[model samples]
Target: MDPSILSGMRGFGVATIPRWPWFVFLAGGMGCLACSSLSHLLACHSKDFNLFFWRLDYAGISLMIVCSFFAPIYYAFFCNPYSRLFYLASISLLGVLAIIALLAPSLSTPRFRPLRATLFLSMGFSGVIPAAHAVILYWGQPHIFVALGYELAMAILYATGAGFYVSRIPERWKPGAFDIAGQSHQIFHVFVVLGALAHSVATLVILDFRLRLPTCAD
Candidate 1:
């Protein structure tokens, strides 16, 4: 066997996992957007509609958070089945808890806005654990650092969005000032979209990086 051929083989030994992360993110994003649009459009129709739509809207947020974990964890641990399974299971459980907590009748009230935001934010922040693990495992790789930076940016954007959603700022500052265009809720939505986009970018970067990492049997 040629030495160069052996070197080439070793260099290309990285594991390739399926692309289910992107699919999970796409589905979750669509679900959240659809629910949000429906809630906004029909909530004014009746009291029952208002209650139901709002609950769906909150549930949509929780669903998105859970789904957001799929890509990074799946790609980061592609060669490490144990870590991948553990992280996936942990996030799935968190998502279920978030959905149940948000769906609770009492927790859906306007008075519980901060509590709701806190729950979602906590779920999002949970990514830090897996992210930190990825860094520790791949500290020598530049792609891991790059992905971590993007993930951090996503977290900041999300936390900022939650702040706007919870505080009702700007709108509260000037009642009806933003009723038509720049309401805090609208701002929150924009930030949420931005955060999701950032997450997608990070996931893709991690996926590409994973493609270059060594495989399990290597």
Candidate 2:
């Protein structure tokens, strides 16, 4: 959001950056949200629906996490095909593994809430690898650091959300008071939305950086 952060990087005619990576992220976000909404809405209908939709919800979270990596990584590593491919493949594999792990009906229950949060948190934190790599590659670039700042905010928000989700606070602290409002899960969802917003800003920053100079030579 700060103009000065990107002031140093002069544009060499705006490059026509590919939009597929961005689209992938958007799709993932939408699908994850849809799955979560549906799960919450319909899971109470029946036991069978509960199992099916909750698993779907977990899988959708994995899908969104995996897709979130696309735009940032692809744009940051636009000049290096190998690193790009490796990161993308690694995340894809992790997502698949997470989905498989979460598909277990036992894991979806409140008893395994910690494990579920850990799995999702692990998937989210795995971005540190490529994020660090990008920082190193673009070291001293003001815009990159700004982007990193947004990412850091995203991480904090997500971690906080997960904490509430795992702890089940408010409601846990006072049994009947939070049943209708101020529940931990509701707070968790709020933080999730905030985290997603932060991530979006970071991604946009990276995309703008790449658009300024699409080619490595630039």
Query: Each model's TM-score?
Result: 0.91, 0.91
Give candidate 2's whole-model lDDT.
0.88
Error of 2 at 10 (Å): 15
Tens digit per residue, CA lDDT, model 2, 1-218: 25553444335434346779989998999998999999989999999999999899889888989999999999999888899999999999999999999998878888999999999999899999999999999998877998999999999999999999999898988899998899998898899888888989999999888876634673
lDDT of 1: 0.86
Counting only residues 3 or more apart in sequence or on different chains, how many pairs clash (N, Cα, C under 3 Å) in candidate 2? 0
Q: What digit string (tens of lDDT, one per residue) describes model 1 on residues 1-218?
A: 36675466565663235677879988998999998999899988998888888888999998998888888898888878899999999989988988888777787788999999998899999888888899999888988888888889999999999999989998889897898898888999999999999888899899878766566675
lDDT of 1 at 67: 89
Q: What is the C-alpha lDDT of each candidate?
A: 0.86, 0.88
Question: Clash number for every model?
Answer: 0, 0
Quote the positional error of residue 122 for candidate 1 in Å: 0.3
Residue 61, candidate 1: Cα error in Å is 0.8
